[model samples]
Target: MSDESNQTEGPIAGISDVPVTLTVSVGRARPTVGELLSLTADDIFTLDKSLDDPVDLYVGDHLVGRGVLEELDEPGSGRLGIRITEIAPIKDLV
Candidate 1:
């Protein structure tokens, strides 16, 4: 077979269009079962991380990246976004 025939059109051609769910872990709270069940409206559940901590980005159980939480500044969008600070190696991701 010719080399051209074996070459892919582009890097990640087959999987580039694949849709994957990316999860952003802002923080975690370890509330007791009683505390969780007894929660009422307007309750403030505290997280283990502070506002300045970097959030973790995960694809399935594997950690893919880390980023800081940000609020989008588009007029009235008010959407929450993440600013990627660190990324796991490609080998680690797969």
Candidate 2:
């Protein structure tokens, strides 16, 4: 194989700077309409997964990967983050 033939553009070369939303799902809850409406300011809706379980990472509505939730102890602003553990199989996305 020639060098020129082997040197092709990468898949996401042009749109590399484009922004995408990534969401991490810790778990899910099912609530009835009345239950949802009855929620108060101090009320809590619990999720199914535990803290140690891996959370699903979604790009839009598509689940692209899974990760673990982590906390960042910044001096001024403490924030939450995720550490990616595994990527979904290509077939899984489709």
What would the TM-score be for candidate 2 when compared with the true structure?
Answer: 0.74
lDDT of candidate 2 over 5-71, digit per residue (tens):
5543556445545689888888999989999889889888889999999999998899999989788
Top lDDT hit? 1
Q: Give lDDT for model 1.
A: 0.86
lDDT against the true structure, each candidate: 0.86, 0.81
Q: For residues 1-94, write the lDDT of model 1, one tens digit per residue.
A: 3455654454554664468999999899989999988999999989989999999999999999999988898857889999999999776855
Error of 1 at 86 (Å): 0.4
Candidate 1 clashing pairs? none
TM of each candidate vs. truth: 0.78, 0.74
Q: How many steric clashes between backbone atoms does each model show?
A: 0, 0
